[model samples]
Target: MSKLDWHADRGTHPDLALLDLAPESVDIDLAAVRLYRLGRVRAEMNKRDIGAVILSDPINIRYATGTRNMQVFSMRNAPARYLLLTADKSILFEFTGCLHLAEGYETVDEVRPSSTASFVAAGADIEAREKAWAADIGNLIAALVGKGARVGLERLNAGSAIALKAEGFEIVDAQEPVEMARSIKSDEEIKCVIASLRATEAAVADMRAAIRPGITENELWSVLHQSVIARNGDYCETRLLNSGPRSNPWFQESSSHVIGENCLILLDTDVVGCHGYYSDFSRTFHSGPDKPTDDQRTLYKTALEQLHHNMDILKPGLTFREYSDKAWNIPEIYEPNRYYLSAHGCGMTGEYPYLYHHRDFADAGYDGVVEPGMTLCVESYIGATGGREGVKLEQQLLITETGTELLSLFPFEEDLM
Candidate 1:
């Protein structure tokens, strides 16, 4: 009989983090991510020949206006924080109650907090918050007029749109300001992502340790949930504890199938650390004292080799198609007809930037260049149908000028049975 072998693999590469992330919401330098955002906003304004930008997307709010509040969770919260940009200077106008930007003068020029929701509900003098909203954007327009540049809007959410319409201010749709900029990560962002990967790896190790025959998939999932929180991984988008037959289908789980001898435990995983930065990693384990079948060993080793081989090819300036096609080929050589997802973005969301599957005779939407500072979760899977089980090899990677680096280390054994 052979024992299951599990090991830790790198999740995010070192030298990937571009900023100093400490203590979560406080004392962290978001300058890198912020500057990148601002630069993109300005670029959009310049392209549209506009002078100012308005932001409404909550996700991009902190990047442009430096306003990170729980208010983002509430759609009722209007865009009181209107950032006015000029050639010589930029000013931000926000509701005053936000503590994070209470006195960040250089970053946020002016703030006006308002609690007009309950007032509006009562239909009383609810004009205070509304006036603040109108005034903030109105003031931004006035500031831009001072610069003599045609005011342009970099981005805005639907709430901001209503306010702009009420103010009779014409807003230019310039979504290009920050979407692509976020595609490329910064050193600080990479660092936070790496930390997230470390925490995820620890949690996965605990989950793997807890796996045994007779355990329910739900039970194993609970172990993973507890393990991740036990570490620094306080929150996660998905706590996948797929095992047994569920391991074959991608993203399969939420089942009650009990683990028996020779069962396969598939852990498709991720964890959030700083802000929304995340780490995604995957590993597979077999629950059994018996030796792995010839097919299991063959597929597992092939996936592992493909992981390392693809890692060697990680670098900057390559098109997404190049990596997808190149990386996919390695797994194809190993597993023949197995499923292979070369890489995907591992940031604020999982399944980001979409998967790298065959499209139009080649990879699609991957034409974007892989530049330095972009972090990706590259994975390869080998599985059979009808609960035949499978194995997945996944690692978090960051693109650097020199090459690629791994964030967390997962088990690297050729066989796990």
Candidate 2:
């Protein structure tokens, strides 16, 4: 086997200086960065002729207003917090107890308590409560942009949409503008992602050290979860922890399955790390008292080659369709279980501009250009037609003006290869 040049030195990168500065000397102005982000969003809004935007997506709200409260809860339910961004002002509609939390931020022009009684009214019919909630939101929207004004709305519940239309407002799709603004990350955002990746990689190293036969998948997963939390990192978004046969088809969450001798263990750390940035990467391991079989080694090598090949092809200025045209093609035998895309963008979490394989691009692809300052996750899943296990590998990348930089430094399992 050839020696792989694992880029283990994180300090050599120019960005490392940003991470090493003393708190007093460091040029980390979060407030300024937040203002820059909001400015970018507003610029996009202006280009689209959007008067204001109603943002309800948690990530969008954070990007626009820099507020974090009950984020996970808001993902499934209607957001308890919302922001109305206008040309000259920003108004945050927060839940009653949460209004105080937004007071410290200079980004918000005003903070108002969002009505919660309607959401919790037990005697009221569900439809009535929804109507009441929508009415309140519509009234707020009207106050911000006035009646008959054109507004961009993101993540609006059906009831809210109807109410807003009834209130004589023109609603346009606002998600794309926010996504486009977020797609190109700022230097501070890059730093946050780097911090998260560092923490997540450290946790993975801890898990690798503890890997062996007889340990349950959950136990190993807990080690990673604990390591991230101990470092003051936010919660992981997925439990993509699985071993052996369970790892074949992919997308399996961690379970109580015991690690058997010479079995492959795959883990994807879909963790949200420092400063609310997400670090997503996957590493495949082999539990051992014995070396992996030849087939396992082959699988690992194939996946690693695919990973590097895709990374090499990625750079600034490539269109999504062009990338799809050049992406690695899975063999006919393994095509059935192939993942949806070879790569996807990442920021707050797994997000847009998913670069599809040539085979899947015709039906699943979207058109966009890869620009500098975009961060992407290049993925590889290699499993045979009847194989019991597969190799899963992913690397986070940041597109630079000249080329691309690898953000994730976690080494592949050399023993498995």
Candidate 3:
């Protein structure tokens, strides 16, 4: 048989198995490219007199240094330092508590013996890890900085970056340039997010089809998870497969709730697709044989219709609130006594720049207009907060030239009841 040809009858392919895990090599070049771009940013900051820029933010650290340490991982503490535009170039530190952990490696090949995965079959080797940790970040930053440069602190944070900054380093914040660099999604980021949405959709669909009256919420999560794995996706984010009424919005899972009759299974499995990317969605499945009662039918159809309306209007230049409020026809919303808005953007952390006001964005500063790269989840739900029944139609979409393009499942049915 040809190397390219596979036995259709074979249960699984060896090559496919070998290619399983998502690329482990951190996107270091991506970080470096952003670093080079930071020089111009530093020039801009210099004009602003933001002296001794220090990057306390995790995103900023990753942006300046090609390694994956500090920042969010060490929320209470950041590892090393990266100083751009300083005559010293960049300076990384070996902090006190940071002695034990090895920041991610150069290649997966080196990752085997002491890596997160390998150490798991056996426990991680603290000694080897510390050595690697000490070696990698220092060398990498030195290379980026080009040795013996008069580097000063470029930034610092109150919580994590504090410990590192105390070590005889100057401190500053490149907040503007670093954030500007991180703000826009690159072509590659968009593709990964797009694949993410697809994986999420598949998982949800699988769970929907497999959802049964006797199955617990957790069981449903397992079924969907299996499907995601089959597609080379993962359900690592959000405590998935765990759901209950008292639970927060993003929690979706199974329980002993005994999918009995008359109960509408409310689900907010917002992050059930990929470890790298996530898509937020909600669906209230009718566990038992459900008849579309008059009220249920009206609300479901209205919610679905409202989602479509906003989807039609979701292109560039439309303010965030505009897309949100338009989803619920004000006149109709008032008529039905519905209070919730339609939906918002779905990406990292399940929902960043949360759409539809829910206390925090009361002023809705997210007047940030839709751009082509933005991926939004259009979901409108009402009826659960003491009102009768509820409806939430969720579909992931991206803004496009002519109109918005739907990346999520289509032909959105009104009654998943």
Best by lDDT: 2
lDDT of 1 at 264: 68
Ranking of predictions according to lDDT: 2, 1, 3
In candidate 2, which residue pairs get closer than 3 Å at backbone N, Cα or C atoms, i.e. clash?
none
lDDT per residue (tens digit) for residues 265-373 in model 2: 9998999876678889999998888888998999899998888899999989999999999888788877888877889989887877789999888898888899998
Per-residue lDDT of candidate 1, residues 1-417 (tens digit): 111111112221121221222334233445555565567666656766666665544445555644445433433554444455654455545455663343432345545443332343325545554455556656657655642334445434444345555665566664554555466666666655666666667777777788789889888878767776665454555646677667766577546888888866777776654455666787878887786787777768767776687777768877766766666454333344355456777665543454464432263454667777767777778764443677877888777888887776876654553
- Whole-structure CA lDDT of model 1: 0.60
Candidate 2 structure lDDT: 0.81
Off by over 4 Å in 1: 1-59, 62-175, 230-234, 330-341, 350-355, 358-363, 385-387
The lDDT for every candidate, in the order shown, is 0.60, 0.81, 0.48
- Model 3's alpha-carbon lDDT is 0.48
Better of 2 and 3 by TM-score: 2
Worst 10 contiguous positions by lDDT, candidate 2: 2-11
TM-score, candidate number 1: 0.70
Q: In model 2, what lDDT does residue 358 have?
A: 93
Q: Candidate 1 — worst ten consecutive residues by lDDT sum?
A: 1-10
* TM-scores, all models, native as reference: 0.70, 0.90, 0.60
- Against the true structure, whose TM-score is highest? 2
